[model samples]
Target: MNGILNVLKPPGMTSFDVVAYLRGILKMKKIGHTGTLDPGAAGVLPICTGKATKAIEYLTDKDKVYRAELLLGVSTDTQDAYGKVINTLEVKASHDEIERAIKSFEGSYSQLPPMYSAIKMNGKKLYELARSGIEVERTPRDVKIHFIDILNITGNRIVFDVGCSKGTYIRTLCSDIGDRLGCGGHMAFLVRMKAGSFDLENALTLEEIKEMAREGTFEKMLTGIDVVFKDYDRISLNEKDKNRFLNGGFVGLSEGKFTPAQKIRVYDHDGAFLALGETVSDRNGKLNLKVDKLFI
Candidate 1:
């Protein structure tokens, strides 16, 4: 109950709905999800429970991978098949033209988020306003597209996989690609393949989770909190120094060259994961390890 759960969220369930379901099964009040997935889309969604909830912020910032289908010659108000068709035109672009247009988005660009989204404006969610038939000018946000892999293109349907930074919308990317091809388009379907180190291969369906809970093996599905900090260097402190770290005091480092503000995984004397720490310089320029996030 204190680790992360790689839940395979099904379509039609909002991210909050998943959290609520897990709360009931686990009977824990301190549960949360890392990021929000559209209700119409399904895929890997990491859920944090108990002390692991502190890792939500770090996990939310990780890049994500998604597989989506882009249907050419048709556009929708919501930028996806779930919305009403607003425009239709014959697809005139060749396969090569479509590929080029999709590849053009593999970099940083300013993207305008769709109105029918969870974005907030003046204390009102954009989707709530869109439901009220209100339209407002929205400021574009800079998002990075790491890569776009065209999996297949048959007739007017183009299937692709994309790796992008956080906040990059696959629906908007599909809409932009269609506009570039001179024919309107929208996202036909979407499935999240990966989020940070979590992938669909290891995600558990709600049914599977329920069986595990009944079998008293639910702990097998919980991932260790240290998995997210695997990239950081590790340091073990003796009992004396471990006490100082637990009390939120900086412990002096005597060896190893570390840059200021460098992150590290702190461990207790018995090799237990303690907290995430960073190198800091005191007023006298002495290097010390300061606690960044405490897991225990």
Candidate 2:
């Protein structure tokens, strides 16, 4: 119960709903989802349980891949099909034009987040203000679109897969593409194909999780918290230093070549993963390992 679950979130259920459902099944209150997926979207959602919750921030910082369908000639208030149609026009752009327009966005750009979003302003969620029939000027944010692969184009519909940094709104990307093609558009469908190291193919549905739980094999579906930091170098501390490290004390490191601020996976003498530590120099310039996040 102290690991991450690669959940295949079903459309129509909010991200919080998935966490609550898992909490009821696992009967544990220490549960959290790494990132929020739109209620109308479906796909990979990593759920952290118990001590794994501490890794949520690291998990959410990873890039995401999404499969999205952009419907040209129509625009909505919410930027997705779930909202009311605010504009419509005839599709006049050619397939080549559409492709070029979508591919042109595969880089850094200032993106205006949709008004009907979860972003907060002055202690009120932007969506709350939009629901109250109010509109506010929102500053555009810098978001990176790693890549956009156009899968197919049928009439006014274009299906594409996008790899992007965190906080990149696929809906907004679709809207911008349509605008570039001279016809506004909206996101018709979306599915998160990947989130960091988690992929949709390996994700489990709620029904599958419940069945596995009944069979007493649900633990097998979990990914260890230490696995999330596998890219970092590891350091095993002796018993004497391990005790001090667990008590939030920095342990002296006389060996190992490490950068000034390099992150490392920490383990105890018996090979139990203990915490995420970073290499630091004390006042006297002595190298020491300090805990970034404690897992034990």
Candidate 3:
């Protein structure tokens, strides 16, 4: 219970709901989710158990991929299909026009988050304010669309796949794509296919996960701790260096090993992850690595 679980979070359950279920089944309290998924969205959600939760930040910046459907005739109050219908519009656009509009968002652009989102505004959750019939001016944030593929287009329904950075809102994206085509649109459905290195192919559903816990095979689906550290530059230490690292002291690293790097992962013997550190130049004109963050 000390690793990552590739859980396929089903629709209608929030990220916290998944962890609470695991807590009841496994009877452990130190469980956390690596990322959050909306209640209406379903897909791969990495659950970290025991000490693995300490390393969640290491994977926060990893790219994510999602497959979603967009309905392009009207918009909603929450920007997704699950919300209350507050607006309707006529569709006077063609499939080719929609495809061309989607092509325009191939790179980076500014996105204005919806009013019903969880983003914080004035020390309170935006969704909380939206529930009280209050609307505020939301600032547009910059986000990158690494890749976007038009999966299907028929009549008024459009489907696509997205590879984007963290915090990219699919509901707002679909709305923008529709707006660009001179029609209204909202998120019809969404399924996250990939988060960092974990894919949905090996994801376990909620019932399957609970069954695994009952069958005493819960640990079988948990991934190794090192699996999440794939993006860092790994540096191995010998017995002596490992002792010094465990004793909490700066160690001199080889010159030109990781030049001009801000963060790197340091591992001990047998490939046990130890700490994250930054490289600095000492007064002796040599490279010295110091721990910026570490775990027990």
CA RMSD of all predictions = 1.0, 1.2, 1.6
User: Model 1 — which ten-residue stretch has the worst lDDT?
Assistant: 252-261
Ranking by lDDT: 1, 2, 3
**lDDT for 15 (candidate 3):** 88
Per-prediction TM-score, please?
Answer: 0.98, 0.97, 0.94
- Window of ten residues with lowest summed lDDT in model 3: 255-264
* Per-residue accuracy of model 2 over 147-265 as CA lDDT, tens digit each: 89999999999999999999888999899888988899999999999998999999999999999988989889999899889889999999999999888898988765787898999
Query: What is each predicted model's overall lDDT from 0 to 1?
Result: 0.93, 0.93, 0.85
User: Tens digit of lDDT per residue, candidate 1, span 1-296?
Assistant: 68999999999999999999988988889999999999999999999988999999999999999999999999999999999999999999988999999999999989999999999999999999998999899999999999999999999999999999999889999999999999989999999999999999999999999889989899888998988898898999999999988898999987566778999999987888889999999999899998999998
Collision pairs in model 3: none
What lDDT does candidate 1 reach at residue 240? 90
* Candidate 2 residue 225 C-alpha distance from true site, Å: 0.6
Measured by TM-score, the strongest candidate is 1
Model 3 alpha-carbon drift over 4 Å, by segment = none
Candidate 1, number of clashes: 0
> Residue 103 lDDT in model 3?
78
